[model samples]
Target: MKFTKETRNAGRGRRDLLSVAGAALATGLAGCSGALERDGDGNGNENEDGNDGDSDSGSDGDSTDAAELRETLAAADPYRMHQYGPSHVGNAGGAGPTSDVDAVWTFREGADDSHYEIGTPAVVDGTVYVPENHSVGDDGAETVVYALDGATGEIEWEWTYPRGTAFGSTVVAEGAVVLGLGGSVVALEADAGTERWRLERDFSDAVTVADGTVYAINTTYADPPTLVAIDLETGRERWTEPLADERMFWPTPPAVADGTVYQGGVELTALSTADGERLWSKDFGNAVTGPPTVTDDACYVPLGDGTVAALESDGTLRWRQSVERGGRGSGLHPVSSPAVADGTLYVTSAWRLTALDADDGAQRWTTETAGDRPPVVADGVVYASGLNVMEAYDGAEGDRLWRYETDASSSSGDKVAPVVGETAFFPSAGLHALRGADATSD
Candidate 1:
């Protein structure tokens, strides 16, 4: 859905703009606060710093997490989800492709039509799953989901629907490529690009997988929006719940951790992954601004008020850290989705990046003008994207190591995170795979 000042409630006016812009600013740059749109390829991670690659919410949550269906992807080799995993840690283990890197390969999908933007990317095993939009017969447009070889830009397999287009992340689960395609939740065979199952929805932007279930928001014209859960193997609805009727923030793609699904709409809500049941709910004076980043210990919620509300599993308030100002068009601006590593939380607030102590919400370090795209943390580096630049910073010291300038995707709400592995795969003008300049090209 297109978000604008005229459509949203007064409380959510300024909060939803961070994604409208690109990369969460360069070092201390400026966070985006325009219009959050989408159109792109989606991708997946490794665990670093002695972090258990698998989240141990320390509860029964782990047992129910079907993310293991894509087991090996837990390593950094594959970026299975948009934010890396069900936990939404946004870490893909090792280091990022530094600024000195060179483009290993690029799959340009630019067309004359404005809606002909590429989708995000998802990497698993050695295949990169992405979507490319194309202008068809004059004003018509269609998106093609392609499974490309990771090492080479060869199209291993591709698929599209009749006059259908896709937006948001591409996910791999239950041994299939899952995506919000053709206005439906689609699962296609990873190796052959064959349809496995399809669940129709009038509109959907993001799709996430957990414990053999697919979670996403579905809407039909004037009907109220509903978050629906679909079985991974079958195209059957498991449960559906009505979303907040108000003009609130509902993260494009919801997140799941510890057997709980986290979403932002009327409020930050935690629901059971087993069934559509509310586990807990909290209000921080405004709707949730960005995707909830869930870790082993806390569920960090970015609020429209420029505050990061740290809450426990039971919805208990842990702490709140304010940004330069509220999400409104005043001070620094509100914060967007954050990446947590070790014990520090890397947040892109308006035109800056701030590192906060995960335990007490104390500021560890802050950048000057930050990029606005959601940050992806790996090894010890944090990567933030912008419309024309990608900045890498030391995860510990917050020092700007290097910056690479490139054309970011103009797709609506194209806030897809960067994929970190042997090469850094960014969803931009198309799909750009960057690697260290010293690395030998195959």
Candidate 2:
């Protein structure tokens, strides 16, 4: 069904039913971290208003149990549509790969030849899921999604779709792997590489699955694009809403938290997760270049003007921070989504990674980095990818920990932010697995 601006609230009955289901699923699948400590410190205590603190901080009276937190971290899905849940915060919850890491294994597709390209991989429950594109014959290309063992870098199973292209990263949800292929969305059993369901449509961007529903944007670079909702299990269309006529140069997928879906395009729009009702809309006057990162209290959007704007849950503007990039115009501004952890917001712009206080938008620290992909935070380290190198920084102090060179070229155009689990996975020309230097002895 199509929803327009006037009839947006037509499906109140169905939306009310979905609201209950969405709430329950959200509580269960919500990322472990949300609030930043009120004192602007990395403490794990709640404030006077009952806002919880950072999960990584060891403060007194924190509700998250240590053992439970560890289990969640161990099973963390690193690339769940922009690194750890629909918020795109890039916070990995528990400890990430340490500074002392060595390449454990490198999996190169079609190593004998040179036509294969692997997209950014998703990690969940000790497995790395990746979609690969390679030439099938002379004129056709094939896309295959492969599940690799996270520890040994071995392929467990692979599902191939002939004569298609998978443009974005893979998402693991509900014990299945979902991705967009050409104009369709396909789900595969995460373990056995069996096809669960496939929905035929025009989805040109990555898919975000949360609260038992999958959110996608069906755009063909034409007017009147659509925001669609599909059943996470059956691949059935729940609702479809027409977006504004503004064309998007890049795909800004929707991020979900607390029963609300935040999407970025010509403007930042908030819609109900239950149905496609337009709750609110805000125009930043500049193109929103990346998907928003949602927390308990605020949603963060990265704009093309080197500014990160934070909004309250009701779509009110909280604060906006502009990172000065010498004299370069907005065109050169980094499009990386902001990553929040330990009460700090980490964003990359103008070849630098800047950390800001999540509460007041105060600048905490800034360090030089390369590339435009969002940084991932785990344990106490921040992982960022630059032209051809992936570097880790001290999460608390913003100190350079170590760097790993992925290719010899200075500008490899590799934008894969390292995904950390038991091991750190980096995707460039191929996938490289690294472990802590001390892991060998242990």
Error of 2 at 12 (Å): 41
The weakest ten consecutive residues by lDDT in model 2 span 1-10
Per-residue CA lDDT of model 2 for 1-442, tens digit only, reads: 0001100011112322232222112112111112112222222112344221111122113334323333443576455555677777788766766655555556652322333455678877667788766664455667778887665555789898765353455788888898876667888888799998998766654578898798887764436777899998898999987777755434466898888888777788889988889999999888776678888788888887778898988889989988644232133454467888878888776557788889988888887653345678877688886434566888788887666544312111213555655456666445666555554333
Question: What is the TM-score (0 to 1) of candidate 1?
Answer: 0.78
Candidate 1 segments exceeding 4 Å error:
1-75, 109-115, 164-166, 220-224, 245-251, 325-332, 440-442
* Model 1: per-residue Cα lDDT over 1-442, one tens digit each: 0001101001111222232221221111232233222222111111122111112112123323223312323355567886788777878776666545545556653422233355568888767888766655544555678887665555788897655343567788768888875457788988899999887755465678988888988743314667799888887889987665645334456889877888775577788877778777776767566678988878898766677889888989999988653132334355777788898888776547788999999999888532566788878888876443456788888887655444332344545546545466665445666655554222
What C-alpha lDDT, on a 0 to 100 scale, does residue 189 get in candidate 1? 89
> Which candidate achieves the best TM-score against the true structure?
1
For model 2, the stretches where C-alpha displacement exceeds 4 angstroms are 1-79, 109-115, 164-166, 246-249, 326-331, 408-418
98 Cα displacement, candidate 2 (Å): 2.3
